[model samples]
Target: MNNTSVEKNLANKTVFPILFAISFSHLLNDTIQSLIPAIYPVIKHTFSLSFSQIGLITLVFQLSSSLLQPFVGLYTDKKPQPYSLALGMSFTLTGLVLLSLSANYHMMLLSVALVGLGSSIFHPEASRIAHSASGGKRGLAQSIFQLGGNAGSSLGPLLAAWIIVPYGQFSVIWFSTIALLAIIILTFVGNWYKGMVGVIKKNSHSITAISPFSKRKVVFSVSILLVLIFSKYFYMASLTSYFTFYMIDKFHVSVQSSQFYLFVFLFSVAAGTLIGGPVGDRFGRKYVIWFSILGTAPFALLLPHANLFWTTVLIVPIGVILASAFSAILVYAQELIPGKVGLVAGLFFGFAFGMGGIGSAIMGKLADETSISHVFFLCSFLPLIGLLTGLLPNIEGDRKKIKSNK
Candidate 1:
């Protein structure tokens, strides 16, 4: 590619609406998931929630999302379409709006469940679409889309901090609904409706549906990936759960200060996701995954030791390392089960991450009984799973043997 050609390619890249939708939907979904932890204290105090009940609320979101993702993936992989993507975002956006409006625990749980289901539909489909639209730049496209989630996750708390005080949590819903409505408009204007439906009907490839019980190689790879997934989730849930508390308890920072730092951590995640994809594309996906995982261990181990005013410089990198793993590994997991991208997305994102939330609750309960530092210690050791992942045989992102037929 010449300089002029490359420049044109880059310019053309900016005009893909399908890519925009995928990223926009991701931002909305992740904001909903990540924002809850920050606001839980407010809700807990209002509803008189105990520690376990708080964990249960988080667990409910993960469980429903995890359980529903596989079905969504199955349907999506079998028939890739844009409607599912649009519909999923609409559902997720609607759920977030409802979340802000909830007056009771039951209503909150119900709202979370909707967000979970909506997310379930969006992730796999958006990923698949991004990969397809990438036109051989799958890594960059995936990275861009992945960044949306991180961006939303980061923005959610900051927005909540601003809006929740004067207007309340329900006010956040208007933001999601309005943003989603724009995506809906963009979806039609971008002509994603006809394009995606056409693509779905065009798919006629045979996907190898290997049962995990029988395929040791695939299952073992999946099991190893699950370990990575679990560790990532622990980092996600535990960090969000206690980060503000840690700041207040250890550094004597005020609630507002701690929350700002927490937002910074999330924003770092957005940066990591945006960077990881291109790095993966330029290097190798395996290298990106393994390096980030290994890089995280030292950070995790060192988190408790940062006591000084300037130590947060160290904390930001740790957050990036922890967050970047998802974008790379998520794509890697989908690639592992080439013909079953949706199922794999569901299994990795929904199931493994869901199970991780349960594990996180256990750690939370342990914190209640034991020392929170001990919980962090246990969390640190979980990254050892990443070392083991290096041993799994790598796989291609898609079934090249069948692409010609498609």
Candidate 2:
């Protein structure tokens, strides 16, 4: 079959369901990860943890995820996406379960580590499968997949709050129960892969020859995308860790009000996710990415100045839209290295994102020193570096150029 026919068949047969499965798994994974910070304050108080000790929780989580991701990526290259994905989800479910049952901070930390390791496995494998199914439309595919996670992260805090508000400390257990149930359902009812036979077979022999070090374009693209995505991850972690507290402490918003504003941010993310995928597919991925980054800076600066509920409401959407920028960058990374989709996905979204959490750990320390308000403004502008990198050139899917030298 011709490339166009193959592309069409892949899209029609495989794309949406796999993306949904990947998204669903990611949604559950990210929800728990996002809730960690919110849970931290309570846990710290309960356990009498020092500031450094509390920060170590994130440090350990990110370190474990980052360390394991490249290896996961290597394994994903050789394995079936479903196997890796299922294993990752299993790890996540197991970790959350352990966390639910934990009475001490050490056990809680171990649970977080388990969740991080599971995430390291899931992201690259699922993303590679999605990218292969997408033909060359990596950005749109990733955007759709990541939109699910953004929605999950956005929803998790509010959900945790709602449950915890009524049940207090026991709410974490309930969260784990929900994740466990979802895993069980997904395991049996999952239709995440429908036509993987052709797609996987076409690339079955390709992974052995794929090496990021040999491909200059892949290396350069990964480096640039890493910086771009790192900024996004740092912002996400910061928002997850600090935004609710910021609203409560700095703006004097009540906990309920703070949670409500978080929901506003999430709503905007959902809107951005819906908008980003189609827009990236149509008008070009670069514009969507640059737009999200350049656009978000002004909103970041405006956030500290906003006093009223309405003002906060407006800025939340800006943050949400900006969060969706990952869709463009991630897609770009995958397309830049076609055959090594798993490696690229793992490096960009998994390892790089974990590194971003490390950056957020530093940001958290900075928040302790200066104000998060001031630090966040600077973080907002960091995406500009990414915007500039996107302007470099279009090298994606240009195999003719790559093979021309031969």
Candidate 3:
């Protein structure tokens, strides 16, 4: 219960049981989150919505999700709220129920907003929990945590295609069961977190973080990382928000088939998430970030010109390559700003969601004004921003130098 005891407790080997529990909870959380976007087509028809309207829905949901995260992370870094996880999921459950029962546009917005609110709460604490339980295996822990989310995300479209698309709007209520299950899992995780509350007062300040770079260099590096995030998530917005429509419009694919294709892309993403962290742990995170983002450029450039079959093939590499970047980027940022795990997680996750929202809105309008093909073409250039990876100071290398000096 004392500070030294707490440090010893926390510094022990990675707690795999706690890690997997949180990862499974993340899967349940994101599975519910993904439902909103997945059901867009059905709701578009039911409510006679426009592409811009769809973008606005994302905007609202994302704002609610993004805006609160930094503050939530900051607050929890101070207080370490053990039970907030379940509280957050309760909001999602309410949102799910409302979304299922929603008969009008405004109500739908409110429902999605509530769901977004739940996400803003969940990520920082969950991420902190993963970090706390990581011992020394930061990258691997983050990857395992993210794998659940990507896997859950990949399930959304497929589940929507099977469940909601056929059963109609009311069937979204069925996913309330998913939300409830998450709440149960989160409650269990919360109990574990409660036991760690002995570290609260010293948690945010006790650890001495040594940065190899100057404050200016660190700030500049963070800006570059943000830019990279913009590139990755903006391009991601094109695919996650509109890929199905793009498929139907260009290839004349059925809605179900488009959903199936989206599943393939997201499943590849899940696979990549599993790879990024461990590889970053083995190699330098800078290399992982460089390869993951920049590596996607070739396939992205080829995507607009490919036929339906080729497009499907291209999305696999796109998803896999692009998906690897986030885990590395996040872990790299945490290394940069050590001990502020919640803030780092919240900032990056919030910014990623913000970029995705803004990107979706801008691209939706672009698709309305130009064509989805044009939108895809323009977005293809985004991965090129990964070139900024050259500028980041090598944290791992710097740490090795520090140790040798010691």
- Candidate 2 Cα deviation (angstroms), residue 80: 2.1
Model 3 lDDT-worst window of ten:
198-207
Candidate that scores best on lDDT:
3
lDDT of 1 by residue, 1-406 (tens): 7755554443334336667766776776677677777776568667888666777787887787788787777887766555666676677676787888898998998888787777777776666666656655657788888888888888866866777644666666667755466457546633654454443333313224443233677678777777777777777777777676567667787666777788988888888887667777676677777877778888777777766454477668877877667767766666565556667666666865587568657866777787666776677766666787677664543334345558
| TM-scores, all models, native as reference | 0.84, 0.85, 0.97
Model 2 lDDT tens row, 65-181:
677666677676766545556667777777777876778878978988897887787677667666665655556677767777777777766876677544655667667765675
Q: Between candidates 1 and 3, which one is better according to lDDT? A: 3
- Candidate 2 residue 93 Cα shift, in angstroms, is 2.0
List the candidate numbers ranked by lDDT, top first. 3, 1, 2
* Residue lDDT tens for model 3, 289-313: 9999999999999999999989999
Model 3 CA lDDT for position 376: 95
The reply for model 1, stretches above 4 Å from the true place, is: 1-15, 182-186, 196-215, 308-311, 394-406
Candidate 2, which segments miss by more than 4 Å at Cα?
1-15, 135-137, 185-199, 203-217, 396-406
Task: Give the lDDT of residue 311 in candidate 3.
Answer: 97
Candidate 1 has what TM-score?
0.84
User: Sorted by TM-score, highest first, which candidate order results?
Assistant: 3, 2, 1
Query: Model 3, 4: alpha-carbon shift in Å?
Result: 4.9
